[model samples]
Target: MYQTTSKKTPWIFCKDIINHPQKAMAWVWGYISCKHSMMYTLFVYTLLLILVLLYYVNHRESEPNHDETFKAKVQQSFIKFVEENMPKRDQNKETRAVYSMRTMSSNGSLLEDEHAKILKQRAGDIQREYIGFKNKKPFNFHCDKCAVVASSGQLLHSNSGQEIDNATCVIRMNNAPTIHYEKDVGARTDIRLVCFRSIDFMNKDTLMIGKARFDKMVIWGMENPKHKKIKETFTSKFIRKYPGVDYYSLSNSGEKKATRLYEEYLGMDRLKSNSWLSTGWFTMLFAVNMCDSITVYGLPDGNQCSAGSKKSILYHYYEKRYDECWMYNQHETRMKTGHRYLTEKAVFKQWAQMFNISFKAPAWNLTNVNASEPIKSPFISKMEKIGKKRTKR
Candidate 1:
């Protein structure tokens, strides 16, 4: 027996909601008015959804930074701020930046300890010896006067060999030969400064090395992985072959300081200028430090560029190739990857005025240069200050 009740069934309500929206809405409103429980359940669910959305927003806002790019930018900004605001106390870690000439009224010689700092000697390391090989002791030799002979073509037929040989010490650069050119370049070779690349020339036997050729050899190169590996490989082979010849290497730090000198005093950025420093540059520095008086031969001075007489001379005395002035002009004016030969010579000119340095075999006329003028480098000027203070004491 079928019985009819006044309450709407679930099936009828669902059908009405699907087929008739107006009737469904009216029935829903009527049900809500009649039943408070259904209204409360809907309100509770809506409130819970709103709360869940709020919680999600808050959780996202509280999360820590995990972005690598954002972190890198923050780190860079902090480093920049520190560098800009802080005063540097350690010269060893000073910025590798090009500084223009700054005048200071002080004069001083580089102290031995300061020299060691520049060299950046390591613990248990010999100051001067064949590096990477056991030595009896550090190299302990000095000369009151030194003659730094150049490989320039200016020495050709100059007949200055005897005068060069007369010096207390003689320094040669790279793999320059004295076998046949001894009459013009001198026969004595006390020290030979070789860049690592010159090792290839030596291996080719184009440049000679032995106890009979030179008393000691100093190999130096810029600080780089390739240069380092080449230096190590060359050192091993050289020591194995010439066991008796004295050998030493200029430290990476020492090379760095030399590059800095070019930047600070000469206003030439080695990196930016793409300038490969000539062996003459290192030879001059060694002479300044090790010799009381230095006489450089066969090298041009600052005035060579402007002087009309130098155009006919060849680039190398051994070879009759490129013209001296033409080579200098090309290298000096090159947009990239060339030695700053003229610029280096000009700085050498300034050094002549400052130190006990003299030029010969195409002598420099530095009579116009003022000796009392301030040195071009702040580091050098600080050294001068120290010298002044020592004099006062």
Candidate 2:
């Protein structure tokens, strides 16, 4: 039905010979090239838009983010707050806290000379094994903001990576890894407090996750320093396991301090759970001395643990629900086993109110317009009110 000139149309000239192969081939090739050109155009425009968006996000010309601004303002407040509680006259900032003695006021002064001596010797030996051991020196750093990252599962999908990374210093608890979980909890580690229980649980290869990854480590020891030689030997083994990292002996001094403090303040009335403060408690103690405005992420404030949700609740990011959450709750329900967690929660709430310290978890609080502070657990207040009523009666 169609006619073509053989001289002008290349396909027409070859129609009899090749059955219009040239024209058919030309049309197919032309269509493909046109489509490819359209795709290329679209790709170029998309790339340009992406570049503009990146420049806008990465550019620092705009005002600082709200969190950044708030943290900056809190810096002056932090220095002043710490100064009031821990005096420079009594506590030197440069004092090598490894040997720093606590004022036995909170806990009765009770360490015997032999126990104190064993603790000192243990600390010296452990320091000698670390990468860099300084004698009688205070921590050689300061930060405007510090983040104490707790391993509570509430951090699961928090999307707090950017905020956590922004801290001047970040202290992580236990053997919690940030590898796959960096989105919820950022991958910054200024210091990590290693629990004695996790010593065997940690791998030598995992410990080799690069020195550049962190600044230093503080190894928490046994709850009670009463074992003398066993404490020293156990602590020495713990340090020897991680030969390459630079770490401090939070072992004896802290153990001795906790013995007095918890006994006098938290223990005497006496559930066995009353004995040792969790490593998180010790970490907070460290932060109080070093940081200004401490914001703890996931320390289990005892607010959201409902009976219906208890089964699904995870106590730690490192443990499975069946493995840890239930066991932890089960232990709490029994006497003398759990670490006075409810009391600890009460103390933390008081501390948060007294100190400028705040909590961040179940992330919506930050993004929501109405919520400024962490929601207080109604149960905690009710318990306090009942205690007050009993006291009045």
Candidate 3:
């Protein structure tokens, strides 16, 4: 009986409410007003959620970054941190990253010597004339005025062609075409940096076409021990065999600071693992080593990936990139594979502060005080003087 009464209590209350007509009318009015207010509040929250969703979806392209100065400052700090510890400064020859020599496993590196040798020997004899990399110290080459040209669509109308040409050496990444893009990217490609994975598909015919142009071809990703076929094929079968082509492989030998920068700043997770750094970063690294006065062209300035009303271009010229660098979530994978370009720029800014480096991006305003040139190397300055005299003569 008690249980039954508990269940009927709500009904008794309703009956009581119904019997008192005036009170019931007042209660109904209060309920109506309260319910209307609650629904209105709920409707406002739903609208806000929709707006947030819209912002999240299109934030990459629609926003225009106005705080380039602040961005530059932040990037400079990254540069300082990376510079204090990078490029692997081991004193022992066997331990350091050998930029001056061919990356053969037989060369007796303390780390990769055994695996590389085994792969090379297993490759056996191939039908090629010039099979070995020139042991003569990175083409016995150095340039005072070098330009590392990135394939950002920002280069499309940058009018940096002349500036690129003016450099003693111009380093380009992948098949960044210069035929039609000569006006924008310049026709002079002194060095072309290709990742080893992409070169495996190229036939002798394709390589022969490029042979007529690019002076020195540097193949990266040779350091990845997983891709043994790329190393074997490049060294043993197809690449070095090409006559008049000086092909060398670059290994991924980074220091702890750089690794931390990738993990902490660039969002790369595994700090100690051997992963493929972007060709752009390594390309810039190579340029800094050889060139006295280095100018980087077409890389996205601080504006591309900035939040809250910032604008950016997807490509340097008209590149067909498989990496979804134009999107936000792609930044998630960048920490793993080293494709987080905007984040990597932090390191580049720090690197520029170390040597004779200058940046030439699309949106560089005259007011940016960080846009100053470093001192030129005496050797490079002399080379530039000689080049100028030759032109005048």
* lDDT tens per residue, model 3, 1-393: 455433323346356555774575464454456555676445445544665676687995576665765544543443443333322323444432332111221234422344323322321111011122675343335788988888777787778888899888888887666777777888787877776766754434443365227777777666567778777776676654565667766544432323333342232233322133576755665565566787888776444444333444555466555322354334423222324454455545645544567778554332322212211222223323433444455
Instruction: Give the candidate order by descending lDDT.
Output: 1, 2, 3
| Ordering by TM-score | 1, 2, 3
Report RMSD for candidate 2: 22.7
Write model 2 residue lDDT over 1-393, tens digit each, in one string: 899743323334234324543354464454445555676445445544665686688775675787767644543343343343333323543432222332231223323343334333433343332222334343434467998888877788778877998999998977788777888888888887766666555444554366326767666564335545544654477456556556565546545554444433331222222234677766765665566688888766553453445446567786775434454444434323355555455545544544557888852122221111222333224323434444455
Each model's C-alpha lDDT?
0.63, 0.54, 0.52
Candidate achieving the largest TM-score: 1
- Colliding pairs, model 2: 94-138, 272-336, 273-336
TM-score of 2: 0.53
CA RMSD of each candidate after superposition: 19.5, 22.7, 17.2
lDDT, residue 183, candidate 3: 78
Better of 1 and 2 by TM-score: 1
Off by over 4 Å in 2: 1-141, 222-244, 251-253, 267-274, 306-311, 321-328, 363-393
The CA root-mean-square deviation of candidate 1, after full C-alpha superposition on the true structure, stands at 19.5
